[model samples]
Target chain A: MTEIKTETDPSGLVYVIGTEEEGMSWIGKESTPVEEPYAIEIRLIEHFAEGIEDPNPLYWSDEYAQQTRWASRIAPWGVIVLCKEHKVWRPEWMEDSGGQDTFFCSTPLPGNKLLATDYEVECYVPLKPGDNVFINEKIIDIKPKTFSLGEGHHITVENYFRNQNGDLCIKDSRTVFRYR
Target chain B: MQLPEIKDTYYEDVEVGDEIPEISIGPLSHTQFLFIASSHHDWYPGHHDVEYAREQGLPDIFMNATWQHALFQRVLCAWAGPNAIPRRIKYRMGKPIVRFDIVKARGVVTGKRIEKDECLVDLDIWLDKQDVDKVTKGSATVVLPSKG
Candidate 1:
């Protein structure tokens, strides 16, 4: 009997498995919409506070929140962050043949690092208990890049968080990865 | 009910190149990671479960992105007044955040602009700890009301 050894071939790497055009087509592939309510009885905000070890009064105490500038109890930022992850659509097709995700890189970033040249988060309203949040997530932008991580499509997933009344509460956008 | 006093940074008060006061947190713990995973309903075992973390090529459960973002928000509010409304927070995760790493949230005011009545503070932020190369880095924007 002979023993055979296996090694990963790093040569001739397929940086972009799909054409730029095909990747562009993925920019608006699908949208995920979900509704969530922040319930007071559950002390949802308190859980977040505990998780982060932050005891901001605005997150749990109505009396303190009423005295704050907003003058009302508001959800912790963590709650909203979890909502973003909750509604994000990570399709199965993005996985490579190796079963490794094409989106996450072995190295997160390369070189001197890019200046956070841009960032925008808009909150039209603060989340409160009994208020329902409507989240509509979509891939809004896609671009080709030969930057630090590697040659791949820079995909931006944007989420619009609206209140039950349809008012925008938060606009969060994160750029994820997809390699060829 | 008396609210915590808010001493806002007005448009005239900040200038480009000013470093926002830095806030330090951590010595990342497994318990914290598990707490966050549970809170977010992110049952991803690698983040908190030790065995799962080892299988994922990590020494142990580490700080996940969600909790890191939550920490960023805490750092942001450290200097921002009650009136400061966070508009954006963009971070590029650099490396695995392991246990007992004391990460520091350091930010600097990069640009300030006036759009109508709003004063927007543009900042370059980075999170790193002793012996740990920067694990997360990005920029943030906030809308602060100007003194009338």
Candidate 2:
């Protein structure tokens, strides 16, 4: 058992290779826009609202939504957080690194002290159930910085969600402190 | 605990410095976190597996960052009306929101303008910790119809 040793990143091995590079090597990288078609029978947005237990009449009844500016049922803006994900290509390393924990084109910190430094999401066309959103993500910027958590990289990920008809539905930018 | 049902805050009435409506949620349950983990791709074992989390040095299962926005979405639509076309939402994540912690989603109107006969409202939004700190911080923009 003495000869047995655990493998390590000897060169301080960057585990999540191509997707995450040293010093802005990945600055211009863009993922193939992921599109997932939503079927009519599923009421995803409403169910998301229900999951949070929000008692909004607009989410519950089309009758109520029509009374407002919207002439039909509309979803709570944040409900889109739970919308079905637009599929994206995952590097084999990422697939094996446990799961999606905000790695977004940067090196992971030593531990789970990551912080949500900042984020931005915008909507152009109102989202409803059965609406297929095509998501395009771009890596805008990454900077090495110091924070309460320790040393980490600050990264910004911008996303644009376009409906099947091609209208921009929602846009979001999330900044994360991937720290040690 | 709850607000009046679906009251419309029209563009003409809203103003800068006014508080963007908010929703409070929390002390999330294990089952709920489990439900979210199962439904979405947020499959980090640390979120559900106590042993894994302990080995990785976490106290217990914790809520993911996405849920903070869920509360924000509820608060915004509750005030501006669901049809209010949202223009943008940006956020900064802070503390780990775990089970049994109450979080309040709050925001304040930062700006407003009129263009193309539509009124646009800009808000600075956040999810507040039980004390003076914030869990997540951000901004949201929405377009509201004119009273006319």
Judging by lDDT against the true structure, name the best candidate.
2
Note the chain A TM-score of all models in turn: 0.59, 0.68
Q: What's the residue-level lDDT of A5 in candidate 1?
A: 27
Docking class of 1: acceptable
How would you encode candidate 2's per-residue C-alpha lDDT over B111-145 as one tens digit per residue?
A: 99887777899898888767646667778877876
Off by over 4 Å in 1: A1-25, A37-42, A81-122, A141-155, A177-180, B1-4
The alpha-carbon RMSD over the true interface for every model, in angstroms, is: 6.2, 5.2
Write the residue-wise lDDT of candidate 1 on A69-96 in tens digits: 7877677555764433332245786643
User: How well is each residue in B1-118 modelled by candidate 1, as lDDT tens digits?
Assistant: 6556546667678889988877776777767776776678655455667875675456776676667677777676667765567777777777667778788878889999988667
TM-scores for all predictions: 0.72, 0.76
Clash numbers, per candidate: 5, 19
Model 1: what TM-score?
0.72
Q: Model 2: per-residue lDDT, tens digit, A119-142?
A: 666666676666666767777888
Q: Give the Cα lDDT of each candidate.
A: 0.62, 0.64
Error of 2 at A81 (Å): 5.9
